[model samples]
Target: MNTAPPHQQAALLRRYQHRIHRVPRNLVVQPTGFCNLDCTYCYLPDRDDKTPMPTAVAEAVARSASELVGGHHRKPLGLIWHAGEPLALGRRRFTELLQPFEELRRKGLLEHAVQTNATLIDDEWCDLLTEYGFRVGVSIDGPKDLTLRRTDRRGRPAFDRIMRGVERLQHRGVPFSLIAVVSRENITHPDRLLDFLAALRPVSIGLNIEESEGVNTERHPPTREQAIEFWLKVLAWSRRQPGGTAPVRELERLGRYLRMSRTQRADRAHLSRVDPLPTIARNGDVFLLSPELAGITAPTYNDFRAGNVLEQPISAILREAHRLSYVGEFLTGLEECESTCEFFDYCRGSQAGNRYFEHQTFAVAETDYCRVTEQAPVLALADTVRKERTT
Candidate 1:
């Protein structure tokens, strides 16, 4: 559909000569998958283990992270506390797990963040979050009725509990953000969702389009037209708001495509490639790229693991990631994508999960996500931009 003339495509390609920025160091540590709520669309359901990473293992992982960043000129590596519910580790143990990273931060080795469901946040948790400079991103679907589907394993509604925790954070003046997953049931009600988020007044809101992953395989993604309608309404609502905290709308492919077209680079607002962003699992196995890779363990082979942090140094993991044929091939695919496609300057290529789902290999390009997010939107944006320029 992106049938830009050859001359226009060449001009666009020439405008984007700079290389994509590569993240030097970062780690997502899954302290535990012990979440209190069982949202219907959770991608981490396979990680239902309640086993917490031992203090020693946490320390080892932190040390490895520090070393990796240090080797890369001490770039600010983000240490994301990811999990079923990282807060489920309880206050004391969570603090213990973070102490090593805190020490690393003090030494200017890395930054820290936490992604939680916010059901357990209290004054004490908020205090810790503020004290440690942890950027909190809470998971909550729009209003109470919509969020009721977020229940415990035993099917108990968790909206009130999560809101109570969110209130604690707000009352304590702890800096936090929100992550909402949009589903078919909620796609047509962007105003209602935006109203609810505006009331929360979070620092920013990230809206994720529902995808078929983990236990969420049964969930239905909105049609492309539905997605476009939802995002356009959200954008219009955001522009109309007077003093309300504007939502970021993370998965709005149109905005990303427009930004990419104008600037000749992919918007880095969403998650980056999984290779440099490691996910340290419960058993100390370090999975390069994404936590999704951890759920892909086969009985006969163990290819996802870069190495065990407890047994190997962080440098080894980085080196191993660089050595992965998939990593090299994936990067090449991105380069090829950039060179060949008229929309190349605007896309970061396909996500690993999408690639795996569509092609069964990480190195292959995912045409589905590309068409829906990059190609179609790029054509639409170019038309708008060209018209504006003409006028």
Candidate 2:
């Protein structure tokens, strides 16, 4: 049990039935716990475990996902092959794992993508990805020196190998996005990072600040001023795209808020704008909302594993899991954001895992995460739009 105050537990359970959501928008399949690199800040607790997901789990999830996406065309249900070094699965084995997902894609029922460190992307891997129309995402942190923490087991720098992988993708003309984890080191020089990425000419960029999760607990979150400046500068650099630059997805999303229609803004019923993203761990343990939420256990919460796909369908499990006490804790946090946060309409309370890690409760609002990711960019862009209107 959580052993928190009884009042706290009671608060979380109030009218919990009202919060049951539909099938998730994204389904993340964590096929293995093995990763070749040793990023010092990695939050995944299972990086050392080499257990690969059983083929049965993937089959079950694929079958369930096929049905969900097939029936509800507008749920935005998709699959993400992530949670560890996805490419490490190797081409042949990965293809088998991707069998169900490819079927979903072929039938036009779902979209699929792989978030890889891009270390093991051979020509064969690229061919498979491109053939299936997978929008691949490469994890990199710009220059070699800046990525000292993301090294291999032999303590070698990962920059060269990752860049080689990046180069391979470019050479093959494979469309991909760069997913960069912004930390204290890279946040200082957004320009150098931007320049390096622009040279590669990625399809897009995703910036994720170092979060206080799992073992990455000791976070050195950037200051409000620093975050504001970095995002704005990055946004400005991205504006030079007509000349040449990859679009930053974070800035693009923030920019969308500036131009949202009343209908778009007011449709708060689908809050978070999507149901919890589901993460099926290697062992068929299902977790919803955040893939990062997998492999962690605290008092009373359990793994938040709704059910195993081998035994039951995901939709059925999630529908029932929605009524669990832990879900109520998170939904209360959502209510907190709605009642208190200025950015509640924009962020829908941020990630549940982030809240529990930072605030020790899932029902709180506004962390350094919300400040840097949701508030800063929107404020920066919204301020710019306001200034343009005045001028």
lDDT of 1 by residue, 1-391 (tens): 1135677545433322222224445678888877777777777754468888899888898777766665467457888888688998899988898887777788777788899888888888888888888888988889987776689878998888889988998888887889887788787898999789878989888877676544456666766677656656666677687865655645345565555557755444333333366788877888765566665643322556768889986667665454444444455566676567665544656555555545656556545556544454345445545767999
Write down the worst ten-residue block by lDDT for model 2. Answer: 11-20
lDDT top scorer: 2
TM-score of each: 0.82, 0.90
Residue-by-residue lDDT tens digits, candidate 2, 1-391: 2344767655543434344356567788898878999888888888988788877888999888976776574734678889879778777778888886776777677777888888888788888888877879999988887778888988888888888888889999998999888888889888888788777889888888778887787757677777888887787677765754678888777656555744476645444454667789999988876777789876567767777898889878765664555676788787787899888777767787888778777777778788988888877777667877999
Q: Give the TM-score of candidate 2.
A: 0.90
Clashing pairs in 1: 274-289, 275-289
Model 1 is weakest, by summed lDDT over 10 consecutive residues, at 12-21
Off by over 4 Å in 2: 1-21, 262-272, 382-391
